[model samples]
Target: MKDVKTRAETLRRTIGHRVVDGKDAAVVTVSQSYPTDADDLWDACTNPERIPRWFLPVSGELRVGGRYQLEGNAGGEILTCAPPKSFSATWEFGGGKSWIEVAVIPEPGGYARFELAHIAHPEGDHWETYGPGAVGIGWDQALLGLGLHIDTGAAVDPSEFEKWSLSPEGLGYVRESGNGWYDADVAAGTDPDAARARADRTIAFYSGT
Candidate 1:
């Protein structure tokens, strides 16, 4: 198993807002570098069969302009697809529509840098109640799973991940990830005090403490 703290610390996150179609939208960006080639990393993320091994099981048509759904998760239409590099899609969940883009960039020494950006409407209530951690933490966990799978070439047990999320080490990782997003929000012009408060709530929700 990987050291939770070290892995969590390695993740980079950014929480910012942008105006899309004249509406304010919040964006959460998570990025990490994996020890693999870009093509291999791209295959792991885009190939439906391989995705389930690391992330969630995905079904339906997967090509550009095709609709796809992750089992018990989000459903959306693929928007942009550039082989071994990037893909953008609409993320529809909880009766709301958002946007997601994933990019795999080649780095030196055969490392692949994975980046994901999730953009959605600013939640007046939930955003203040939980801040970016609600989303950032989720992505952080997914990135962790992906990194582990890539490094070890093994399927991560979903049940074990669920149980780990409640463990003390996992809770520590959650808190740290939440704090990272809180800083990002502050840097993006959010009130520091407000952001910190929401981060506290988010950490509590994920840690169950």
Candidate 2:
């Protein structure tokens, strides 16, 4: 992978709480700047053909109110779209549903900012057990793949990622990312010790250890 350790540190993670339709929800945000333009970055994100290059094989209608399925992953309806800027979609998987928004903003320094926000109302003690790192770490890896694709025009092999994620370097990257989210969790008023414990469990879960 392209500087996996650097990629883990490059991301900014934030955990925020909100009231979503009478229920408490967590909003996990991850953003990173890449050497690309907003239009290209937006295309890489929303285009079905390009998505599989870095993320997953997606099959869906590319319009508002259309349904999209990300192979073996989440599937949901496109809620809103503004093209080359931002979009909102439902994230339905694991028998539960949440909301996700993607924003591509052009920075002044010739880079585009890719920001993803995943908002969910966790069931039971799921948040206490896994914390934001549960999803934050996954997004870290996905964005890293996007960065690699943007830099080298290469497709990131999913199987290779699965194998690399268990390797030493991968574990290190995962640990760093989980801890970063742990810090964000603490900033969001979670107990430090409890958040650290959750980060550990999340790392172990993702690294399959």
Candidate 3:
């Protein structure tokens, strides 16, 4: 297993707010640079065959305007597609709809940065209780698998990773991810004490405490 502290620190998280279709929406962005070119990185993200090796098993017509679904997860319409660059889609799950944008940015030395932004409108007190750590930490976990796959060229056993998430070491990584999101929320204008409280709860939720 990878070191919890180092793996948790690999991704960068951020929080922001905006109006989407006249409703106040919160944006949670988690990004990390991968040791690959833009095309290869994009292929890993969009290819159904490769995605399941790291992320969830996905099935659907994966093209612009087509709908796709992740196994036991979100399903949504593909809004736009620009190969090797970015894609935008609707994230539909649990009767809630949100927007997601993913970008693959090329860096020098053939490196690429993968960025994903999930924007959701808070209807209840969910935002207050969980904050960005709610989604930020989840994405961090998925991206960690992506990093492992890219680095080692080996498929991560889904069952193993799932079981690991409930283990002691996994909980440590989850907590560290939550801490990072808490700091990001504070940097984005959330009150420190309040954000810390939310982060604690969010950490517990993911860690099954």
Candidate 4:
């Protein structure tokens, strides 16, 4: 099992937001380096069977312009696909449309760097309410699962892992991540007090603290 520190390091992801076409959208970016070929990393992300082992169980045509759904998660349309390098998709959920992109770049020693971004809807006061915490926490968990799945052909079930959110270690990580986002929110010129308060509520919700 991976230690809490290792998992926490993976959770040190970033969140960015902006208004696009008069709508508020949040983007969550997570990156990690793996000691695997770029082709293998790309396959793990794009392959249907392998994807569930790391990210979510996915079913779709998989080609560009194809529609796909993640088991119990978001469903979207594939926008672009460049094998062993990059892919983009339209992520639709909660009556909003977002975009996700994944990029894989080769490194020395048969390693590769994988980066993922999830862009959220740009509208309403939702950005202020849930922008940072939403993307930050979610991607943190996703990256953690990805690291595990890549190293070992196993994944923590989403449902079961959600329950772990209430554990002491889980709550601690949530609080820490929320605080990190709080800092980013303030630096981004968002109202720090409001962002911090929102983070508090979000932490409470996930951690049951």
Query: For model 1, how does the per-residue alpha-carbon lDDT over 117-180 read when each residue is reduced to its tens digit?
Result: 9998976598778878888999998998998899888888999988988887888889888888
Alpha-carbon shift of residue 16 in model 3 (angstroms): 1.0
Candidate 1: where are CA atoms >4 Å away?
A: none
Residue-by-residue lDDT tens digits, candidate 3, 1-209: 76668878878888888999998899999999988999999999998999999999999999998999999999999999999799999999999999999999999998999999999999699999999999888899989999989998889999999898888888888988999999999999989999999999999899777
Model 1 scores what on Cα lDDT? 0.89
Q: In model 3, which runs have C-alpha deviations exceeding 4 angstroms?
A: none
TM-score between model 4 and native:
0.85
List residue ranges in candidate 2 displaced over 4 A.
none
Which parts of model 4 have CA positions greater than 4 angstroms off? 10-12, 17-24, 157-160
Clashing pairs in 2: none
C-alpha displacement of 62 in model 1, angstroms? 0.3
CA lDDT, every model vs. true structure: 0.89, 0.91, 0.92, 0.75
Task: Score candidate 2 by TM-score against the native.
Answer: 0.97
Better of 3 and 4 by TM-score: 3
Candidate numbers, best lDDT first, in rank order: 3, 2, 1, 4
lDDT of 2 at 30: 99
* lDDT over C-alpha atoms for residue 60 of model 1: 88
Total clashing pairs for each candidate:
0, 0, 0, 4
**Cα lDDT of model 4 by residue, 93-142, tens digit:** 77778888989989998888888888877467766566577667777667
Count of clashing pairs, candidate 1: 0
